[model samples]
Target: MSEDAGRVPAEPPDLRVGHEERAAAMRALDTHFEAGRLDVTEYGERSGVAGTATHRHELEELFTDLPAPHPEFSPAAGPPAVPEKAPDRHPLGHRHTAMALLPLLAVIGIVLLVVVGGQPAGLAFFPIVFLLAGRFGPRRF
Candidate 1:
């Protein structure tokens, strides 16, 4: 048999979101909006997350149940859409030398926890030391 025979296949274009999943997400969105927990402007902005026609329709249905769409509404400023890149796009934001101490810190925490768990004051000091070490230590990065 060829190596490619082991590959799992893809679906045809027609299948999108399953109906039940769409309805549930819609219900949660509607409940938040209807409870006065969400204002109309906020609702308009967030409703874009539904990501499909069916999901939007479900929300519109819920809106129909509300008493009135309030007038004099300000259009909500949309939050910026954050663009994503592949993991390798950004170098891990760090100083090269700083990472050297991470293992040491872990060892310190584990040893302190094990050796000092029997003492109340030492146990308390353990976390304080760990936090201070994290702040001022780590090779100045």
Candidate 2:
């Protein structure tokens, strides 16, 4: 009789996984979700599982049905490659930041207009900001 017939296979060298490994697995999951391999709920559930996983096998299970992430995207190796420039760069990369300040700008304008112009000219700014936001808001930028 072969003495090794019943021995179990050994685990891979990647036995313990830290936060970075878990995060890399989640990124792969995200890519799959974006490609429509998984629905929202499935993505959320798997993401939660990946986030809490502490072992390599546990993380592997999350992507068992999906292709492995590219080596550049693998967290186990190192941080993912950063683009030379951001994926989407605005004129100054501050369009969104400026857009976010719209409300505050509107409020300040309203206060100034009401105080200086002695009219509700500030209220007029809302429509302009609203239009600007609609034109350059999340949908596009």
Candidate 3:
């Protein structure tokens, strides 16, 4: 009956939703399912709807019947907080370059001793290097 009566009511704005939002919703759904709040059939149905949901509210609807597990992950909130840590690299792996060169040097020294200092000198060098390598090379135990 008013001047604005001719105008149609505006639809609710479609809040943007992405994989992060959908994944959070899924985690909430999983929590509820694990706690016996939702059955397999219901969980599967809600999970499917969540994965395909476009708006934020559409994803939120999947958890409407369940209680919130955490405030940060509630439907009203966006994505949950996930802390990232840098992977730890092997501490001793870098020393492998130097370790590899040790054997090559020992072989070269033995060859030179045989050519320049004769067989007796080369024979004396072999046992000394062998004992040193066994005693100081990479530990077995």
Q: How large an RMSD does model 1 have?
A: 17.0
Writing each residue's lDDT as its tens digit, candidate 2 over 1-141 gives: 797899866656457777677777877888888889899999999889888876787776776677756212233444568868655555666767777677667667777888888996566677776776665556552
Note the Cα lDDT for every prediction shown: 0.54, 0.71, 0.72
Error of 1 at 122 (Å): 99
The residue pairs in collision within model 2 are none
lDDT of 1 by residue, 1-141 (tens): 998899856433233344454555556667778788678886766565543544233344544544554211122335668898657532754553465466467657666766776544444555655675666464431
TM-scores, in order shown? 0.24, 0.40, 0.41
Q: Which runs in model 2 stand beyond 4 Å of their true positions?
A: 1-14, 70-141
Q: Pick the candidate with the highest lDDT.
A: 3
Note the clash tally of each candidate.
0, 0, 0
Cα miss at 72, model 1 (Å)?
Answer: 35
Ranking of predictions according to TM-score: 3, 2, 1
Residues 13-119 of candidate 3: C-alpha lDDT, one tens digit per residue: 37667788788888888898999999999989988998898886686666666677621332344467888875645467768547756766887889888888677
How do these models rank on lDDT, best leading? 3, 2, 1
lDDT (0-100) at residue 70 of candidate 2?
24
Q: Where is model 3 poorest over a 10-residue stretch in terms of lDDT?
A: 69-78
Clashes (candidate 1): 0
